[model samples]
Structure formats: C-alpha cells, structure tokens
Target chain A: MGTVTGKVLPQPTRDEIRVETVLQALADPVRLRMVAELANSAEPIPCGHFDVEVGKSTVTHHVRTLREAGVIEVRQVGTARASTLRKDDLDARFPGLLTGVLSGVD
Target chain B: MGTVTGKVLPQPTRDEIRVETVLQALADPVRLRMVAELANSAEPIPCGHFDVEVGKSTVTHHVRTLREAGVIEVRQVGTARASTLRKDDLDARFPGLLTGVLSGVD
Candidate 1:
C-alpha cells in the first residue's frame, strides 16, 4: 500500500495573519524554539532538521501555525520541505515584533 | 453596605510577560479594542470609560489580562482606575511590535 502525500500550500495572505492566529502560534515554547532556530539560521532549514522533541504530528501542527501566521515560509525541494523565516512579512505586519520576541528568548 | 475594594496590584515583572500571556491577552477582540483606545488616548483613561459591550466582569477580566501582559498600566485615582498604554515598555521589549499592530488595525 502506498501512502498519500499532501500538497504544499502557498503562503498565507496578509488578511489571514490575524492577531489571534499569530499570538496562538507563538504561545507555545516548542514553536518559539523552532522560530528562534529559523531566525538564527542564514538559510532555509529542512523540516526534518528541527530537533523538536514533540511528536511528529505536533511538530507539523506547530509549523503550520507559524506558516499561517506569516512568520515562516515553506518551500518544497523534491521530497524534503525547506522552511525560512518570513522576516520581511512579519516586519511589515508587526514592525519590530519578531526581533523583540527573538531577543526575549535569548 | 460598603463594597470592599481589592487593592490594585503593581505591574508585572519583565519576566512575567511571557509570549503566551502576551499573546493570550491580545488574542481577544475586546482586549484589542481596549488597547487601541488606550494607544489613541493622549492621557490615561479611567477603566469606567471603556465602551465595551460585554458584561462588566468580562470587561474587567479582559483589562486584567492586558495589564498583566505589560501592555497597559493601571493606576488608581480616587475610586476609579486609569489605564494607559505602556508603549515604551512594549517598544523596548518588542521594538516595532506595537506600532505594527496598531497600524495594522487602521
């Protein structure tokens, strides 16, 4: 039996990045760590590289939340998915919000 | 019968303003409205002046959340409390975070 793969979606529209959604996405420690890791990285990171201790499903959910909040951008490279911080979009939407938050985690 | 008023508390410490608490506080529409109003006001506004449509207790809860998030500062004046946006603290903590959020609502 073959497993089905889901399609990779486009980035969320600005209207979709509501305050509630963004807040909810950043509320979790695991997600915050993921975000911080992404911020510190100079290039896109493969989803498989995150050392998150949560279940795979939970990690997927957190990544989806971050993507939906316009905090990260995801792209497909063959079978692997690469995620990059959408620092520009976040800066446009919330100004220095991400920088401050990233600093707080240090 | 005289009402026994609970003492107004001091501001939350810097360590207390976790991402979760701040996100949770700003997640609600009512609280966002209150923060917007405070941001626009040139001076501290009395808590009684908020035109929120929710029940008084609910409004109080929302205000408390904002206060605890370090998004707003509350000072008692006579029998009423005045709430002001803690723009500097927010800015210091999150850089352009508040400005971006405030502009997004416009």
Candidate 2:
C-alpha cells in the first residue's frame, strides 16, 4: 500500500515541462491564487496553507498539475510536503515571462 | 434567435481577461499549435484553415476559449471567421513573454 501510494506521485521530466503545460497549469483561478501566494512567499509553503475551498481530492489534483507543469516543486519534509514556485526554471525557460505576468496579477 | 446567437458569442471585457485564463487556454496541445501557427502568420487565418482533428464543436470551443482569454481575436470576413493572435495585448499585459517562449518552440 505504501509503495503504491508512492508510485502514484508525479515525477515530471524537463522535456515534459512545455510552455503549454505551464500555461494550462496557471489557467485555473484557484491554481493562480495558489501560485500567487507561493510567489509572494519568501519560503516554501506547506500545501495545507493554501485556503482554496476545493475538496481535498481536487486540491491534490491541482497541486499535481502544477508540479507536473514545472510551475512548482514539491519536497517532502517530515509528514508535510512543501511547495515552492520554480521561478528559476520558468525564468530559464522563458526569460522575464513569470516575473512579468506576476507583476500584473495585482 | 439572431440576438440570442449573437449574445452567445463572447465579448470579453479587458478586466475579464486574466493570466490564468490565458494560460489555461494555451495549455491544450491543439490550441498551442493554433497559436504557434497564428504567431508565425503575418496576417489573420481563417478558422477552417487549422487542421485540428477534433470535432467542429470542439474546435469552436477551443477557439472560443482562446478568444475569451484574450490570446486571440476573431473577426467575420464574408462567410468565414478569421482569427489572429492578440500579440499586442499580450505584450502590453506581459512584456516579452510571448516572444521569449515562442523562440523555444522549435
């Protein structure tokens, strides 16, 4: 059971992180809010910190989508998982793209 | 019926446009290809010129999504509807963002 749950986790490759995926991941309002919050944070945020009103299953789905799209990175620390925006990856993939959009989010 | 049909067509306000909507619209593979083709074109392309294998209804839906998200603009010309990338709007909204990612598509 433990191994099965572990196998279900996402492990996205660099090649899979296409611009379309990144865009799609950011398209949802809920996901965008989460991304905005993460962008504004100085440290990695626990997944639970996001106040999205979706069901737990949907929240997991959104997080997985973002993670697979390379918009964010997740790491397990103790019993909690921390997510951080992959600002550097996005910058390298499309220079000034993320920063520019983020500025307009306000 | 004419009024209803016209009203069904989207007329998105500037404020209605959001980054997440744009990102979501481009996330689909077919839409991304369409955007790439539009980006490569110097002028507007007829909606039917896109060879996407999806059903006509689905294609229309995709186009509507792009149009509503402010990624593309549509105009009626004779019997056909033409679509063009809203490059200038995107530029104003997020400077150098589209051009940068487009360069990496190849």
Candidate 3:
C-alpha cells in the first residue's frame, strides 16, 4: 500500500521470535509446505513461487503468519513480495529446530 | 471414564505422527513446558507432575493433545495417567524434531 518501491515488511527480529509462535506458524500443512519450499530454495522466492495449492488470499495470510512469527522475511521485490526463510536466525536461536522440522516436512 | 486399572489412551501410532500435528500440539506454552518436563524426567510423569499452572481439566486437555499428537505416551499409573514423551517413536519418525523443540523449551 505504500510506495511501489521495495519495502522490507515488518517481521519479528531474531530475538523476538518465540518458540511457541514459530511452532504455531508451522502447525498448518500449507504453511509447512511453504517453509519447506523456501528451505529448499537457494534464493528468495516470490509469494507465488511456493507450491501450495491454496488461493492467493490464503497464501497471503499464510505468508503473513510466517512473517509475523519470524519464520521468514519478506521484502517487496517490484510488485511482488519475495520471502526468505530466516534459517540463520532460527538456527542461532533454537539450534536444530528448523532442520528438525524440515526433516519431517513432507 | 474407562476402567481404573491401566487403560492406555488412544494415540496416533508412530507412523501416523504428522509433523503439523506435532507442531500444533507443541505450539502452546503450557504444552511445551509439559513436554520439556517430560523430556527431562527419567520416569513417566503423572499429569499432576507437570508444573503447568492451569486447572485440572485444562491440564488433562493438554496432556490428551500431546498424547493424540504422538508426542507423548500415556499409561494408567494407579489412579493417575502417567505420560512419557514418545521420544523413541518420534525420533524414528521425525528424527531430531523433539530434540530441537526441547532445546528451545523454556
């Protein structure tokens, strides 16, 4: 809604990421897939790049949840928001949590 | 409600344990602490053994959620149901997930 330029959206700082919140975000199957795909990607992926079969608005909601929970970071890239997993930050905070989750992310 | 002897509760089998379900069950602060306490203990703990501040019914609900998610095993111990983390089964199914979550538990 702001300028058309790239905007780094609000996300929880590493220290603000809570275990309960992160787990809550990942509790949904669709969101889990989104995180799994992001983990497999070598680069930031636009919102539509996730393989989830949900509608656009639902995808947006899932993305927002993940962002708010500090599981991922989104940066506006042109007209689309590109999301990147906060792997480094998560690893630093919870050690092997993401890896463990990803291991079971099928 | 069943017999007072030792009625094992209905729970998902090891192969049926889903990542999303596990995350959902652990997403709550009280449940997470319950798991943390169970993880640290050497013996199965009665529902009353957990340090959660919730009332009796709430504690029962949380324990049932964990048991249903296959994160913990509940067995009738005298008049109480003692719960033990399904560590071995969860490890076989999701690898380091429990360890990672436990690492972050408060």
Q: Which candidate is the best by TM-score?
A: 3
**Candidate 1 lDDT, tens digit per residue, A5-106?**
434558787656666567667767888889999988886777768878988788788878888777787877677777888787777777767776776675
Residues A3-87, candidate 2: write the lDDT tens digits.
Answer: 1111123656655577766777777888888898999988777678787898877877888888988888887766767787888
DockQ scores of the candidates:
0.46, 0.43, 0.64
What lDDT score goes with residue B57 in model 3? 93
Ranking by DockQ: 3, 1, 2
lDDT of 2 by residue, B5-90 (tens): 11123546655667766777776889888898999987777778886888878888888888988888887766777788888888
Q: Where in model 1 is the C-alpha error above 4 Å?
A: A1-8, A14-16, B1-8, B14-16
Measured against the true chain A, the candidates' chain A TM-scores are 0.84, 0.83, 0.92
Could you give candidate 3's per-residue lDDT for residues A1-106 as a string of tens digits?
3323468899988888888888999988899999999999887888887887989999999999999999998999878899888899999888878887887876
CAPRI rating of model 3: medium
Structural similarity to truth (TM-score) of each candidate:
0.82, 0.79, 0.88
Docking class of 2: acceptable
Interface RMSD of each: 2.2, 1.9, 1.3
